[model samples]
Target: MWSEIIGKFKGMPSQEKVVRLLLERGFQVDGQGHVVSGRIEIPHTQIAREVGVDRRVVDATTEMILKDDILKRVFMNIHSIASFKDVAPLLGLGVIIITPDNAQNIGILNDVTSVISMFNLSIRQAVTDDPFFTDEPKMTVITNDVIPGELVSELRKLKSVKSVTIQ
Candidate 1:
């Protein structure tokens, strides 16, 4: 699905960057070609600066997205989520980042969470990167308390997991 969406901007690198940024941050391209987070409008200049493209490029990209039925549907419905991984330490929560060998592989989350549950750790939140949106997708689990090294080792041994980082 992402491949198909990205293919639409084949010859337009700047537009591709704009689209990727929009998708990553869950910014919507409204019917009027404005970049918005929910109902709040985000200026084209700000988006362009973050993507290192001209404001005109951002405008053009949003216009193109709004023009396409599929893109318009996707952009209009996408949303952002509040992830706790970044602020876990400040909140005295344990953070575990799992890099999977294949994010598309099923059962990775269940297996990892089972291991964490076996240790009786209370999970605060669990977030997984959408495989289509990220090249190296990962799963982040926030726990109520620090995770033990033994559990980290067990998570690393999961067939689907490539690496495990605990904080």
Candidate 2:
């Protein structure tokens, strides 16, 4: 999937430079002077220095990448794919409401417990809607073992969450 997106940029005249930039900084800079970070959380300054472009240029590139939803999705998918190798062994999925005041805390707790459970089972799919903000979004998860009935029950206890459904 990552290769396919990168291939899309191959026809561009700046394809080589873009590839080089992406390889060096995990993202490519466009003419609009935007910058994007790669899977490993790249710093803006590092990207700018490597691409031989100013920090402002790198910043612009980041904005450009964000403006294009399709491109942004591709970048995220590529990033997720690249990082999958590291998390492949963890057979667990997570779900959390975004509106909860303790969303972050809940998310962290979910991740930790999920990791622990992954050792005992296999994760099928994990999906979340706006897992960061307080916007009352839904989260979904599917796993081999249901990730312990108690944990889901606990998350549903939060005041900010409207409800919890498990299938």
Candidate 3:
């Protein structure tokens, strides 16, 4: 799905940078061609600076998105999410990072959570990096308390997990 979105900007790397940035940050293009995150307008200059492209490149990218029906539909509905991976430990929560053998494999989240549940630990949050955007995608699971050390061995037993680390 992401490849399809990015394929349209082939041969135009600068605009591609803009498109990647917009998708990365979940910034959407409005009908008026403004870059926004749920009603708040984002200046093209700021976007360009982030992606190391010219302001005009961001403008042109959004213009192209608005012109294409598929791109417009996608960008109009995309949104950002809040993750607790970084803040979990700071707030006395335990963090588990799992690097899967194959990110594309299904049921990894459910399987991991099931193992976590057996430990009787309550989950606070779970976030998985998009393989399309991340070079090495991993899953971050936050628990209300530190997980048992023995759980590590159990997690390693799962065929889907390549490695697991508790922080």
lDDT of 3 by residue, 6-57 (tens): 9999999999889888898888888999999998999999999998988999
Lowest summed lDDT across 10 adjacent residues in model 3 is found at: 80-89
Please list the C-alpha lDDT of all candidates, in the order they appear: 0.93, 0.48, 0.91
Model 1 misplaced regions, further than 4 Å: none
Clashing residue pairs found in predicted model 3: none
Q: In model 3, what is the error at residue 100, expressed in angstroms?
A: 0.4
In terms of TM-score, the best-performing candidate is: 3
Task: Return the candidate ranking by lDDT, descending.
Answer: 1, 3, 2
- Model 1 Cα lDDT, one tens digit per residue, 59-115: 899889888999999998999889988889998899999999999898999999999
TM-score of each predicted structure versus truth:
0.93, 0.30, 0.94
lDDT measured at residue 47 in model 1 versus the true structure, 0 to 100: 96
The reply for model 2, stretches above 4 Å from the true place, is: 1-20, 23-40, 80-167
Stretches off by above 4 angstroms in model 3 are none
Alpha carbon lDDT at 85, candidate 2: 21
lDDT of 2: 0.48
**Candidate number with the higher lDDT (1 or 3):** 1
Q: Given candidate 1, what's the lDDT at residue 63?
A: 86
